[model samples]
Target: MTVVKFLRLPENVDLPLPSYATPGAAGMDLRACLPDGDVILDPGCIALVPTGFAVEIPSGTEMQIRPRSGLAVRHGLMIPNSPGTVDEDYRGSVKVALLNAGKEPFTIGHGDRIAQAVIAPILKPQIVEVDTLSETERGSGGFGSTGVKE
Candidate 1:
């Protein structure tokens, strides 16, 4: 397994570190590190909730920030940029961009599990420009072209 180095901010030293919910979990839960009071996200509003920590990810890998399933289903809370990418080179505090999609306001308490991060390997593909390209069976099929079910 790859080892990741984490630096906890002074303000968040007392907060619990991110951990996997279960043995089979692919991602670790990230909590809100609000120094003040709870944050109220009004409907249709977006906010960047800080995690109050930084990480040193190994090269050729990235941390993907994903929304919590419970929050999305029960409270309509979602990560605006689902599977948000944290490049391996980034060493700044991790923050989650949360969006309130429900009609009612959502309150995010301190230390609440606001998001999850999945550390995964990434591949950089080389791009080649060509005058002609090959076509596929579903070439340029936009939107619902695939129908409701496969």
Candidate 2:
């Protein structure tokens, strides 16, 4: 298993570290580190919620920050950039950008599970310039080219 090192900010020392909710969970739950009052997110508004922790991910891997399904379904909360990438070299505080899509305003309290992070290997493929390219059956089909009932 790949290990990730985390540094808790002084102000958020009382907060719990990120943890997997279940044995088969693929990502670890990240909590909101708000020291002040709750964040009130108006409909169609976006907020950068801090996690107050910096992570040291192993080389060749990245941490993907994703929205929690429950929050998305129940509160219409979403991560604008779903699966936000945290490069291995990043050592700054982790923050999740949340967008409220619901009609009603939503409140985010401190220690609320705002997002999840998954550590996965990254592939860096070499780029090459070629005059000719191969063609396939689905080449340049674009959106909706494949039938919906496939």
Candidate 3:
């Protein structure tokens, strides 16, 4: 298992790491953040909640951002940019952009665990230049190249 250390900048920023886990993984807490007064997530209104902390990741590592499943199923809420990426070189506070897809408005209050971030190692691919390239069976196939029915 990878060792990820979390730093809580503020006195109240105690983001539970186990709240965010891999797919098909079960945890102790069903949910952390409690609902506040009703608030709508209209277009252009990025619902970002601050973690109130900054992370220090060693070089060649990155963090993957994901949404809470329970909220998505019950309230039609999700992260606008699913699987948000945070670079190792970044030095800013982490936040989540939540979007409400439901017809009614949703509320989020202070100390509410709106989102979770996971740390992972990053691999950089080498750039190659060549005059000739190889071909494949489905060569040059763009969007909708595969069978639409299938």
Candidate 4:
């Protein structure tokens, strides 16, 4: 397990820190740190909600911002840039860009659980120049190349 250090900003001093919902949970819940009462996200609109904290992530790893399953299923809320990556060297406040796909508007209140963040290691692949590629039965087939039904 990797340990990440988080610094809470002035606006978030009274808010709860991000934490895993359960013992088996892989991601930690992130909350909205809106200083105002609430913000309304109209249908088909997107808003960047601040988490009011910056993190010190270990090198070779990234923090992935994700949407909560309950919000997506019940309110049509989604993270526009799903799995948004926060590089290890970044020191800016973490924020979540939430998009409302439902027909009605969604209200985001201060300290509301808006998203979840997961820390994962990143892999850097070596790039090599190739003249020709190997042949295969399904070489270059994509976008439903295989049969839809079995």
Candidate 5:
């Protein structure tokens, strides 16, 4: 298990730190830290909700903020940039940008689970320029070049 050190802002003392909902869960639930109560998000609108916590992510790893499955299926809420990355060098409060796609306005209350944080390993590969590349059967095929097959 990787160790992630966190700092809770003064205004977020009442809020719980992000945690895995289940023993086998791959990500931890990140909660909203609204200082002014509930926030209404209209259809096609986006809001950057603060998580009230700053993290010191270990080197060689990154924290990816992702949309929750339940919110997407039930409320049509999603992260504008899915899997938003928090690099190891960042030391600011973690936030999630949520977009409301549903017809009705969605209310985001304080301490509500808004997103999930997934810690993943990062790999930096050295770049090398090549004159020509090997070709495959589906070479130069873009988009639906490969038809759906069962």
Candidate 6:
């Protein structure tokens, strides 16, 4: 197997923590910095918390903002927009939008690890607008049209 690595740094006023990523992996520690490192979100609720940093990602690449699998499965907690796209051109502080789908509130305290981010390559395409487009096998089929039963 091959490995890909890219250098990243926290922008001004943003501190980068020691990453504990294993071989061939990229990881960064995120702190909640809220009460007890927990931010409580009620059912059907949403909360946006700073990631305590900003980044200068290189062009032709992107960062995926995904929720911790453990948090999602165990607490019904997740990023409202799973796999949130962080465009390399964006220079603002990164924030996570968390929502609670469970029946109770979930708390995120200060220094509590909230989400995990993965950096990956991105492809840039030139715009070519057309009046018509090609169709697919299931053209315009609505959701669930694929099938409900096996």
Q: Rate the local accuracy (lDDT) of all candidates.
A: 0.92, 0.94, 0.63, 0.94, 0.94, 0.70
User: lDDT per residue, candidate 4, 56-107, as tens digits?
Assistant: 9999999999999999999999999998999999999999999999889999
TM-score of 3: 0.71
Question: Which segments of model 6 are wrong by more than 4 Å?
Answer: 1-29, 35-38
Q: In every candidate, how many clashes are there?
A: 0, 0, 0, 0, 0, 11
lDDT of 5 by residue, 1-150 (tens): 779988998779788879999999999999999987999999999999999999998899999999999999899999989989999999998999999998999999999999999999999999999999999998899898888895
lDDT by residue for model 2 (1-150), tens: 768999998769678889999999999999999998799999999999999899999999999999999999999999999989999999999999999998999999999999999999999999999998899999989889997895
lDDT of 6 by residue, 1-150 (tens): 323233333322333452545676465545553532456688889999776666667677787888877788998888888888778878776778888987888877666677877778887689898998899999989889889888
Instruction: Record all residue pairs in model 4 with backbone atoms less than 3 Å apart, i.e. clashing.
Output: none
**lDDT (tens digit, per residue) of candidate 1 on 43-111:** 999999999899889999999999999999999999999999999999999999999999899999989
Model 4 worst lDDT run, 10 consecutive residues: 8-17
- Which sections of candidate 4 miss by over 4 Å? none
Candidate 4 structure lDDT: 0.94
Worst 10 residues of 3 by lDDT: 26-35
Clashing pairs in 5: none
Per-model TM-score on C-alpha atoms: 0.96, 0.96, 0.71, 0.94, 0.96, 0.73
Better of 1 and 4 by lDDT: 4
Which candidate number has the best TM-score? 2
Which segments of model 5 are wrong by more than 4 Å?
Answer: none
Q: What is the lDDT of residue 12 in candidate 4?
A: 84
lDDT (Cα, 0-100) at 128 in candidate 2: 98
> Which structure is stronger by lDDT: 3 or 5?
5
Model 5 poorest 10 in a row by lDDT? 9-18
